[model samples]
Target: MPKKRGKKYTEAAKKVEAALAANGDGGLAPEEACKIVKATSTSKFDATVEAHIRLGVDPRHAEQMVRGSVVLPNGTGKKVRVAVFATGDKVREAQDAG
Candidate 1:
């Protein structure tokens, strides 16, 4: 099969790319990125980016954080567990299907 080219980079993604490039070899670490995100980006979703950036998290890490939190392969460091509550049947269905 022919390898397909990826979709065109998004304008926002381009901006991020340029910003990183401009920072050069000693570019922004995750923590620094998060700080910049916190200082500039103002949407609710951006907060996750900010936190990741501040923690020196990588782009993929930032993406995962924004996508939604998840358990790590190693699992939570503790043996404790918690229950999740759903507000409605739809949410329950989504949880089950997911």
Candidate 2:
């Protein structure tokens, strides 16, 4: 139990604390507190750190995704190719957007 808690919590706590503090004062009312946090903490990505925890992934995996190495793992069995299709003018947009 200690091993599980130690490995998971140690990696997650600092980032979570910083994110919460950046969101708003932790003492505020629940609804108001959540609203401030949500409004302040928007990322362009569809997924978020909290969602990863709710989905039961280890925080180390989350850190890898944040650091961009998770998407490009050399040891993964399959190589992935991403495709984008658009009108003639949108090719540059696709690359820029990624």
Candidate 3:
């Protein structure tokens, strides 16, 4: 026998299904996706948005592996602090840059 979802789980599933129905299972523009996410958020705290991408490269072969980093256009919603250890010119450059 299959287990049944509780009332809360069922209600949440309905909400998700409704959202999916309203927004068809097609590729959405970034702005449109953000709007949908914000409208559906039911928490007092800010919600997190994530993306999962599948690349056409083989990971087993070291030569075919890919690595890179990107800076988000709007910046991540987190604070970062920089710490540097240096002497003379490097220390002066860091202090001046700050």
Best by lDDT: 3
- Candidate 3 local lDDT, 1-98, one digit each (tens): 97987775676667656766777864555676566667666678977779655576899999998999999998988888899999989999999888
lDDT values for all models: 0.60, 0.57, 0.75
| Best model per TM-score | 3
Error of 2 at 14 (Å): 1.3
Residue 71, candidate 1: alpha-carbon lDDT: 70
TM-score against truth, every candidate: 0.28, 0.21, 0.41
Residue 85, candidate 3: Cα error in Å is 9.5
Worst 10 residues of 3 by lDDT: 25-34
Q: What ranges in model 2 sit over 4 Å off?
A: 1-5, 27-98
Give candidate 3's root-mean-square deviation (CA, Å): 5.3
**lDDT of model 1 at position 51:** 36
Which of 2 and 3 is ahead in TM-score? 3
Per-residue CA lDDT of model 1 for 1-98, tens digit only, reads 96654344344455567778888875677766765555555355734431323445565664645345877898867886546666778677867765
Rank the models by lDDT, top first. 3, 1, 2
Clashes within 3 Å, all models in order:
7, 0, 0
